[model samples]
Target: MTTTPARERTRHEIVRQAMGLFQDRGYSAVSLQDIASAAGCSKATVLYHFNGKAAVLAAVLEPAAADLAALVAAADQLSRAAAQEFAIGEFTDLAVRYRGVMDVVQELIPFIQEMPELALLVADGIRLKGFLAGSDDPLEQDLAGFALNGLTAECRHADGRTDEELHRLCEAALNRLFRPS
Candidate 1:
């Protein structure tokens, strides 16, 4: 379903509230009523804006997916270290920009992995599959190494880790991933 300009604000509210609900509780744990309550709207209102929970999830995920693709596109020109730095910086920036959306994305990993088609969608559209796939380092070709980012995202809520700390952590992980083998 498409969102019209007039209803865009409401749509944004619903998605934003839903994103928070997803982060606080796991995606499956959140119901439409839960989101509506958090959004200060009725369930019917949310349903009116989005067909269902999945549609809400789609709306929330769409931009993040696009941003991941943009990250991949931007990393295409740099050296291995440069690309890793860029990817880590952008990845951390994305997490900060999206307001807990990383929680949603990380939570979806199991479902994405279980469904090959969904996995392909994430890999192609989200670009998280091969975060630094084009890097000069062969180690960067593997998606598993990127899990460190997910862990970092999950734990970043803890005290003492500033945004700079998160970036440094991500960058260090990138370096570790691309370390000479």
Candidate 2:
């Protein structure tokens, strides 16, 4: 369907407001009225633009999800070591760029398995974890992957840090995590 400019603008606004609400309040705590209030639209207008809250959440997460999928696909084509470096760099870039979304995603973990719209993100996350770990042993790789994931997620909560600063900090921590012992 061809979206009129006004409709597109309203959709964008809804997604933008939904992202902040989801980040600040968590998905379960946010209501259609809350999103509508933040977006300066009526709840029915929100429903007109999106099917419901889950749809709004999907729209809010779409950009970051697309970037992550692309990163995973690109990294999948490289050698193990090259993929590791590529994934780490790309993942840190994503983590910093989508810090708020990262927090939302972290909060959504408990529900991700049940959200069909988030299935690609969940799969890409698994692939990204493997690339980030870059270890030969299964146990070591799992441990390293979880640590890297936790580190990136926690860094998003570093108040008062600029994006550049967060990028550097996350990149350095990731590199150190993957560095040979």
- Per lDDT, the best of the predicted structures is 2
lDDT digits (tens) for residues 62-176 of candidate 2: 9999999999999989999899999889998899888888888887877788888778888888888888887677985787668656855766586889888888888888788
Clashes of 1: 0
Model 1: per-residue Cα lDDT over 41-104, one tens digit each: 8899999998888778877777876777688777766665576567766766766666466667
Q: What TM-score would you give candidate 1 relative to the actual structure?
A: 0.72
* Candidate 1 lDDT for residue 163: 65
Model 2 bad stretches (over 4 Å): 1-4
Clashing pairs in 2: none
- The lowest-lDDT stretch of 10 consecutive residues in candidate 2 is 147-156
Cα lDDT computed for each candidate against the true fold: 0.67, 0.85
